[model samples]
Target: MSQGKSLEHLKIVLTDIELATENFAEKYCIGSGGYGKVYKAQLEHFDSSNWSSKEGVNKYDLPKRRSTVAIKHIFNPEGKEGFITEIETLSSCKHDNIISLLGFCDEGPDHMILIYELASRGSLENYFESDDKMTYLTWVQRIKICLDIAHGLKYIHTNTDQDKQKIIHRDIKSANILLGDNWEAKIADFGLSKIHPADQEASTLNTHTIAGTNVYLDPEYKKYGRLNKKSDIYSFGVVLFEILTGRLAYDRIYTKVNKKGIAPIARHHFENGTLIEIIDHKIKEEAYGHVFALSKGPNKDSLDIFSEIAYRCLVETQAQRPTIDDVIHKLKKALQAQEKSQKENFKMSLEDIKSATQNFSDDNIVGRGSFGNVYKGVASHANGHTIIAAKRLDRRLFGHGETEYFRELDIPLKYKHENVIRLVGYCDDEIEKIILHEFASRGRLDGYLSDASLTWVMRLKICIDIASGLNFLHATDVNQEVVIHRDIKSSNILLFDDWKAKIAGFGLSLVCPVNKDIDYVIDDAAGTIGYSDPLYSKTHFLTKESDIFSLGAVLFDILCGKQSSIKLDDEHVFLPFLAKNRYQVGKLDELVFEGIKEQVDLQSFVTYARIAYQCLHHKRERRPKAGEVVIQLKRALEFKVS
Candidate 1:
């Protein structure tokens, strides 16, 4: 193809590129590699409509639209060949898991720029780097990301059409996997990709120069300069180890042990049944043994299957490894097992729920909400007379119909986090809809906030518990959907015998649209008055941040030992406002509940207060994510323990 023909579709000019990048300013540089530098720039975007009338259209005309883009500037003469190769490779490839190449510029012999759709979160390597402070990827996220990369590779290896040729991505490392705004993984950096002939039976290439990252390079390819699709699988196996262990492919610790790389170390652990020993500490602490504990699916069994696949991919010979299709088939079966394992075994009949609640006697009632009343009961079944809390929905309420009741039951039943209320069973019949849960002996968190007997240590623990639950809900690992607790407050937090806080009341919850990378919006803001986010109430735009704002109110309630609905006067001064005022004036200690004031460490209290204040930021973007809040609360708990 001629340069003019390629330029026709790209329609980018040198002036627009220079203006967007500020004449290649250093400040615009986001990353650099052996080839050249990558710059982030805001450029004018043209739609099909803008170029529809070709009679009046100019190639350089501004479209009056803007979008963020990444620009790669190639400095090496050899790099120019790679840049052109990437354009030729990506132009014909279109997949959701593959990064899109928007356009390219070839100006003389020294300057070549490739434009790609910006991946806001950058490369996957950034998250695993030693100095990275971002929250660790949850187990479900790691699995999904691996599946996504596999799908992309499957597409590359399979013949999409007779016209499209097969290609091998030589560099399939974490650094080449970019994350978009919704955290979707996209395979990127095709500079080192090799195209195979249409008639090549084995799809193997022989070259004198061995290419790709050292730690992830295929042993066969590295030794004999033999390149094939399995080479990509080998690199992918190394990445799986990185994801599982949260360590580099080639770490100093492994080097010290003479293991040199992760593959050997992981194989040794897997063979000895000590794989769990080398698993990421966070996963072990929060997700081990309880495969269904973190999300609705994807447990230890699924992980074992994944590990076996990775192990097979790292075999010494190329023919011994499974093909991409075989890997996909095995992964799908593993995911199916994960989802099947998450199926709830307790499907009690209406008669059973009645037997448990003693025919809804007033004496058995433990609590009440706008839509329902909770009853304390002993459910007799396989587990045998387990103490339970049965929530009976009142049909008279506006939204307490069969659909709403099931929605409420579905949210709690899908989750398995320790801090989340456990759903025992549910009953949906003509007479009523009831959901049963594990009973909290100590009752709601608000009941104990004002108790003079509660210690500061206990209070800190409650905060951590609440944060953990919120973090789990906000996480996208649950069936690829994020749950937003539209109603979050102290009254909804139930405490067990040991004062472990469990979040309940999902009647007002919202789940992000399936497979979407956007937040769910509601017409009306539904939550307790003092705890509802003011911005959400005014704009009617609901998001996970709204839950964070509500949590901020809970934190304030914990500190001041005041009810969220309590007003300073008839004028209705909210609790968050008063707490913020005190916090900003350096008099936050004045707001600490009198009972725990003396017991609270000054530094710990300050840290807690600061995090809560940030959560209350009027701008949703300014508020800390639930994961960040969890980190800060854990740190505050440590200070208290010290």
Candidate 2:
């Protein structure tokens, strides 16, 4: 169909669009491009009684109710050709993953406009800018989004329609991928899209102008001036990296480290066995068991497969890269594997757990809290007999027994990590409430900190382990919930036979739903006095940084071999304050326990002390993320081996 004919078929009145957009208000504009700005507007219900239908009119019909729409107002005359091309391309194609062109307005050449379905969730670019929003996308969600883009691209590449022809979306960056409600990804911005001529023998289209974002642009296309479906594949590979790393394709930090775009850096790591090193720490921790495994086939982890596909797509030679169809197949298979691995058996009968603990015998009790007693038990199941910790809540002591029991159960069931305490099962009987956890054979870290036999290497390992566990809890990728361990004292750090640390105690933990923002307001501060964040106590606002503060105290306790709340004669000196003060005056080495001080490397000791000092900063924003702390601690641990 001709451009004029297509415009007539659209049947969108210029006056109606003007009224809907309030004369193209700047406040209503959601985004802008080289040609024009895209404004979000609500159009009045379209009445069939007042409209006439042509052959193509029914296809572009609007809903009866006031519906949200995006109106692109083309201002530049040079861009009019691009606008017409977009209309011609989108009007011919109809895929669920492709953005729908609702209507068009061509009142005059200067006042040209095209209407499209509103993507309420905005573009994928917006989510990457902030840590809180990035947490909303899990490994599954990220894979699903990639699959959606692949399906749309597949449709464009393989369309057999004579009139439509094969098209290449020249700009396939994260900013062009619009997300609707539930984060359904749709490919948008067809301004730079190129249609391949049917008569041409070669699929590549030679263009004088270099279009698309530099970071995501294919190296082959940039150097050779050749554009094809593989260009889209290359750009999509960058998006895959963004999904995995939670970093922009051209992030300054990544560019500085690699001296090129993220693709080269990713490829280098992919060739090496250290791809896991560059993966977003949040997803890396969540995918620990499944991703890092060397096994293949049904036992093979999905993350490995996904990374391989991404690597294939990012090959320097365009022809060597996998097609969109191949990407779709691999992504689907990886998603299935991931889903299977995530399925867990977290339920247990009250009788089974009770029998395991000998009916909560006083002699079996391992530890006690204000509202509960933890008893060691042996439970036999399909996985064989395993030692378990049965936390039996005392209803008489705690007013909200059922709530606390379920809260403790809910968190553990949602997360699975080596450093995290696993919830084996739960027993919620009317008379008794109990939660079963994997028992730590060596008991709490506090119990063995002053044992005298513990070496500097062992202490460093424990500190690293604790940091890893805290990083997992504070990660946004795990259910998009930032878990703040309000009470992160030394007693809460449990140890296994191999001296591995597992963080426990979830009764006072607060789950800050990250879909909104980071800081959450609570009615009252709930934590041990010395270990609690001073900022949280004063402001009544809880955040993941508060947990970092508590971890700082634990780090000091590990170093000095003393509790945070211990009395110091006339006035009690909080461990965080004492450590920070001593470290500033170069007295940190003086506070180190005599047992490990002789073996501690001066450089490693100073690094550890610096991390703890930063965590205890008065300003929460100045504190490093738990993941950053993990990296620093790991580096400090390496000093022992050296």
Candidate 3:
């Protein structure tokens, strides 16, 4: 390691250290451990070429003092070897998460001290015991801290071109990790760490001693005296569970019953599907607070993915555990999910919304929704004036406990897509309940159904836009939950300038599993009477296919230039029934929208009618998925321009 070249410039005189630490006084010490007592002080460190007195402190002309630093005074023989090992380990390593070594004292027989960059926030162990710190550690912050530690561990585990040997930290725990002023974590106390030989092929080394914290020691390392890289991984896994449950591994809840600590208890809870029972209570409390509030707790999907990776690390078999790289990958996905839940958007003041809508005047009234009145307004922000549609729900009708209104508000906080209407902001101040969206210039799609100027080409494009948005809600490629928009009809679809259609009015959206297409949510049938699927009314099961049934009703309305149901002889008749009867009798064209049927290409009409027909199939199994519907609709559009 070229010890002479490295350690020569780092040597500091004992008297200068005494001045900084007050001669190892008790008041200067910040903390103490098995190694020694650590002190924090403002130490004087002159630039090499600035003052050439060959001494750090000059009585006649003092050098410029550096920032505050920590100094560890090694007092006993137990700490002597550790003092040398720390210098060897930290000198070769350089990373944001790993603490930096500033200087050392080795001249006198009584003093053996090492100085490091001070971490003001202290160790992670204090968070569990301190109330203010504990409250500050949100689920989002916890995930980020875990990522920082994992990245630092990965850097040491990786074999670099300059230094092929990997460094293994034998002791890893909350106490050994220090948090900086910005809440960034830095790993400390590398005295017990060991460097794996660069030339050796075998990862494990036969050691007579297994040294580490009692709770964090690797089971395999203790049983067989085999020291390997996976040993560090096992220890880090305990720290992961510690961050999740907000309990120290050495705490009596885990250590008193089983010295192995949180590994067994956490792993068992994860397997039994009761991991929520062990989650920090603070997180659960915040998750159920006012739903429309800006601050959102960790999402369910995010928690599931995080606990899954942490559980795999506790597997009894060493080979079954995930590698550091794999752990980092899963951790990234977990953080992404958490960020999606607490998305960065606006929290508009009530005054801002009132100003935009002119105090909810009659002139700005745009339309009506199930639980609210839509008002068109112009909101002022940093960019410019943005036209917005603010849907203000009547508190009396919602009763303050209805879940549907909150669910619609939750969408803006968790998900965003181009085909879906963008949520501008929301205001839930007192009785004023509002959800804002980008104003669609052309109003609702139903308002334009009978207008002949809405050409056949534009109609096909609108159909594709709706299908694409619905497909996004039900996409299964990622680990997100499926969104089965319970209400699908022409009134809920809004058109913007250039005929861009966006799916809106998600007050009745139901979230389900993507793989379980027919795995329904058992809720009372609640949708527009004419557009609702028949199966949902009978069985009270709202599923993805039920949404498809409603889509079919909308398609037929587009073709016939009318709503899904109309009056005949003073009684209502459904379009699906009338259209299916005509199709079977080879008379489907008899109901085409007047003046537009002649402009539509025959092949395009044939493609659209057939796909729309399959969507209304009596058997839900025969109905195509949202993805299939998109593909067929695109095929229909291609023939129109050909």
> How many pairs of residues in model 2 come into backbone collision?
0
- TM-score for every candidate vs. truth? 0.58, 0.53, 0.54
- The lDDT-based order of candidates, best leading, equals 2, 1, 3
Please say which candidate is ahead in lDDT: 2 or 3. 2
lDDT of 3 by residue, 179-273 (tens): 86446677888888888867778877888988998788888888887877788788888888888888888778977878778889998899898
Task: In model 3, state the lDDT of residue 55.
Answer: 39
Best by lDDT: 2
* Residues 1-642 of candidate 1: C-alpha lDDT, one tens digit per residue: 333454456656677788999999999999998788999987765433244443335656634345568998888888766777788888767776888777777776666888887887798888777534324465655667787788889878786686678989999988899886446688998988998866777778998999888888899999999999999998888888887777778777676775448878888888898988887766555432222133332367877887788888888788898988778766766665555554443456777778878998999998887667989988775324689889888878634365657667878766557898987777766667788888999999888878978788888889889988888778633225688888899999999999999898888887776456546567767888889999888888888899999999999899888877665657667889888888889988887889888888877898899999999998888898786687678678877887
The better-scoring model by TM-score among 2 and 3 is: 3
* C-alpha RMSD of candidate 3: 22.8
- Which digits, one per residue and each the tens of the lDDT, describe model 2 over residues 225-272? 999999999999999988888888888978777655799989989999
Name the 10 consecutive residues with the lowest summed lDDT in model 3: 287-296
Per-candidate RMSD, Å = 12.0, 19.6, 22.8
**For model 2, what is the error of residue 610's alpha carbon versus the real structure, in angstroms, after optimal superposition?**
1.0
Clashing pairs in 3: none
Worst 10 residues of 2 by lDDT: 288-297
